[model samples]
Target chain A: MDVSFLFGQFLGGLTTAMFLFLIASGLSLVFGVMRVLNFAHGSFYMIGAYLAWQAMQWLEPTLHRFWLAALVAALGVALLGAVIERVLLRHLYGREELYQLLFTYALVLILGDAAKAIWGTQQLSVSRPPLLAGGLDILGTTLPTYNLFIMLIGPAIAVAAWLLLTRSNAGRLVRAAALDREMLGALGANVGAIYTGMFVVSSFLAGLAGALVTPIQSIVPGMDVEIIVEAFIVVVIGGLGSFWGTFWGSVIYGQVLSFGILVFPSFSIFSVFALMAVILIVRPWGLFGRPIR
Target chain B: MSRCRILAAACLAACLAPFAAGAESTIKIGFPMPLSGPAAVYGAPVTKGAEMAVQEINAHGGVLGHKLELLERDSKASADEAVRLARELIIKDNVDFLVGTLTSAEAPAVSTIAKENRIVFIAPTSKSVQLTSPKNLHPYLFRLASNTDIEGHSAASIIAGWKEVKRVAIIAPDYAYGRDAVAAFIGYLKKARPDIQIVDQQWPKLGQSDFTPFITAQMGTHPDAIFCDVYGGDFVTFAKQAGPLGYFKAVNNRLVDGGEVGTTDEAQALGADYPYGIWSDAYDPVIWAGDEPPEHKAFIEHLKAFTHEKYGSGWAIMGYSAIVALTDAIKKANSTDSDKVSKSLLGLTFDTPVGKRTFNAKTHETEMGEFWGQMVKGEHYPFAIISNPKYLAVGPFTD
Candidate 1:
């Protein structure tokens, strides 16, 4: 009956979309260049939140700098990502895609349990840095300051990633590989290094996304399931291989979430899933996606 | 040939001693809890409490001269898996009785199956009111833990006493537990204070990390107080994100209700300043001060020692009470039969870790009254320092 309520719902959906994009981009990068459908991608994001919370606790009393902690957290996760890839994932590259998917999927179980062990089954969170704790008080309605930070971070990361991919030789190799993997190998490129790089960057993106949202969500063990499920939804909806498509898909998803709640309180979550199903039936490869096969 | 025959005789005798001991030993109770899984943090302590109670009872000349033997299975807070484990314990392990299914959801599944098989089932941590209701129509089911009704009444009692609380806004997970809790709480409050207005109510899905929208919507109403019934990791998330938005601090008063908040450690982990001075209806997580009842003092000191020796937390207290309730029923019943045990459980009077517990035949569930406390130190062990809180004993509903 009311149009303004409809508009409010749209904004809510958009906010949810922004977070989904951050998760899907990294997942798509690895899936695009390498054939690994890393189910552990969600774990990386979960770890990012845990590590940031841990870092914040240690640094808060002494350093008083959340930014410093945030940076260190992101970098720490990146290093952790590289280590995991080298030790476990690297060897599995030549294996079948199903094996890679299954292996990473198994990692989800282990990591989920391990997090429970290390974190003691308690929920932990880092504070939003003092500068961003309060809302901007938009007109009569209030928007969370942390949300604005996330909204900006999503696009900023996209732009930075695009620049890196377009500008650097490493980026060129990654794109070339993503575009044509066998050709890159035939062209005298040591595709193994490229795969490793792509995985590291991808995992790093996951970690960064985790670290960024530390202020806004509590980190817990089973949290991986929730984050990963949402990540897959975004990846599938945005298309399996398109970064920009992932961005738009996230926007669409966020809107679905927000408006879903406003339009029909009972079925907001279901609405997004329904939209995804419709999209898949019409375009199996996703909105802007090319089929990997 | 003589040496081989003698060795065979020795092996048979060694195995038979325990079996022979079982005939003389108290009725063996086979129990399984989530000792090492997602719910282990809660399940492990409960096992300790139950085991300790079983040990204490046995030391006092056993349950009817038969020592209680406990066989525990790890359910890992899963339903199907828990039922499978229950079957293994019943048919394969041959546990004489079943005692626990950690979560509310899992309790019904295992209890339903156990009821069908004619085994007495007891739940330690299940807060769902469904198990004890007459709707089950089976006589073998029992629950030791207090349900949402007790918790809701606790909130109502506090609300009744408060001077500044008028209108309330409610937020809880959209699930059976959440709905039950909200319904019971609202019912109690309405009965206690007819004038209190409920401005807004928000129900978010379980395991959801985002609460900004709900928080925003609640703030718009600007109710004098807010009630949250969501628990576990979700409570932690709600508090953390809501804090950044300055919603809790800005709200005049708030009441947070969660099973996880029963522990001070969980509160501390959310953030040092979490629940941020909010009032909660939870377990009193401290060694009570002043001249206390002898039994209460002894219970507190014994639990402290057990916790220290076993790296335990406060959660072990409830499990300890379950053990107490079970033993009390067994000793009073003076029989080991499942039917007799089920009858003994109904209207049984017993000393419990949370205080005196009495079950109603109508509900088949015992009451462990709430421990109300405010968040203190916000982020530390023993964060909740409660004043002398009341333990209200009420009967189950007609349903």
Candidate 2:
């Protein structure tokens, strides 16, 4: 009820929103350009987390750099995404969207099992970098420094993505491809290369989100399912391929979930679905999503 | 015979091998557990425990002149899958006994099928008090783990001993297990220390990756102690987020959590960040360090060698106990008939790695024990170990 309490809740919501945005944005970007809903995006995120944990084990002693490990993990997932897109996803582009969905869904199962086989069935965590291990006092509330760092990452990524999509020649090609892939191909835009790039970037975002969250949340095998569900919720609410839509959708979702718990502790889990149902009823395409081409 | 006919006959023979083996007077127990997924942390060890027990029983010339056979199935931690697997095990596999449904829901779902089909069901690590409550009790259903009441009271009894503690905050997942655990703890805590006031109650949704809201909300109330039931990955998240937020550092505030938070897995998950001095409870504690019965020692050692680890998971002990209870019940009845085994299991005594346990005939619930101790940095163990473990018996409060 008080200012401090409200401020605390807002911060919590914002922190949650940041991670949601990072994951959903990648999903939305891939869906926009490729028109393929990657169910394995969450698995990519999970793989990212596991990769970071493994990297930390090797690097922490020698490099002592959490940031470097996170970067390496994200890039590693990008490479994996590139390989998947080249070998599997590229071959199925002209097929029915259902085939694409099933393919990615299979990846979720395979990758999840792979992670289990590699990491074993135990929750693992990475420590917060020494510089950001504690909290910062703001308006008499102790906000975790790591949370603030995560919160800042969302906007930084948003800005970077905006620049990449709008300001660069590569961005133009990607957008052109998203708008009309057949035309882009006819115009000699090398659409295949653009698709591969988009997938890599998308996977990098998912992986970055996973690596960033390692210090805050326990990394576990089934975590992919938990996060992917929420990411889908964000993607659905934001509109399938709209960039800005994802940003606002994540904000709405995060705030609703955080504040909803305080008001309706027993029903907070349902609030997201309720909101989704309402949104679907009014706007089936989502808030920022364009009608299917 | 023609070449095609020869190949077909060989394929037919390979397909029927398991059925032929089953016909050879073996008692089959269907073991359904979450061998994968998030719950696998608990389920995997539990499966190991059941397998260990089966091996030991078989080594000892088997039960009732029948070689014990374990047919393992992955429940995937879904209640529907557990029920489906139970049906397959019962109708298709023709298993005589059902063992190891890990979660609170999976246990009852499979138990209902077992009850209706008149097959003996043994739950290894189900902690929900409702499973063995009078309303849910049936002739076919039996559990060999400490129910929520036992753990809650055990936790409460220890909290009551802290004379300096006054106000307590409760944080648990918003589910049957969590709500029931908090309720049982409060019921017993109120009885033990009437003066203590519950200031805040925070129920986060299960698998919630972030606990900042709950932690911050609970911290605002400024209770002297916090009682948390968040376990596994969620517990690790809560500890990591709350540890740096000064939730455990405030003056005169202590933290006590259920057993899952104190396991070697949790400790290993958190590493140096694992908070010390917090009182924690476990289903299996490291209490047999100096002197343990040879059977208990052997069980622990074999499980460690089998699991290839030093720390013995409580779920492993519970899993072992479940089979031990089932085999002992069958021995007592001198028959594998469901009715006879069920009747014999009532008030049946069995020796487990934990200690001697008795199944109450009325509740169909066994009086197993849990160990309570403080988490401290151990020289001999990884992460933190539960120090000064004292065994607490199940029953009394929930009954």
Error of 1 at B196 (Å): 5.4
Query: What is the per-residue lDDT of model 2 for residues B76-104, given as tens digits with 9 covering 90 to 100?
Result: 99999999999999999889999888889
Clashing pairs in 2: B259-B281
Which DockQ value does candidate 1 get? 0.39
Once fitted onto the true fold, the runs of candidate 2 whose alpha carbons sit more than 4 angstroms away are: A291-293, B1-16, B251-253, B287-295, B394-399
Best by lDDT: 2
Number of the predicted model whose DockQ against the real structure is largest:
2
For candidate 1, write residues B74-168 as lDDT tens digits: 88788888899888888887776888878877888888778877888878788877767667647888777778777766666666567687888
Enumerate the chain B TM-scores of all models.
Answer: 0.85, 0.94
| Interface RMSD, Å, model 1 | 3.0
- Using TM-score as the measure, which candidate wins? 2
lDDT against the true structure, per candidate, is 0.72, 0.85
TM-score of 1: 0.87
Q: Write the per-residue lDDT of candidate 2 for residues A1-293, one digit (tens) a residue.
A: 68887888888788888888988889999998899999999999999999999999887364358889899999999999999999999999999999999999999999999999999898899988888987889987888888888888898888899998999999999999988899989988799999999999999999988998899899988999899899888888988889988998999998888777777665657777889999999998999988874
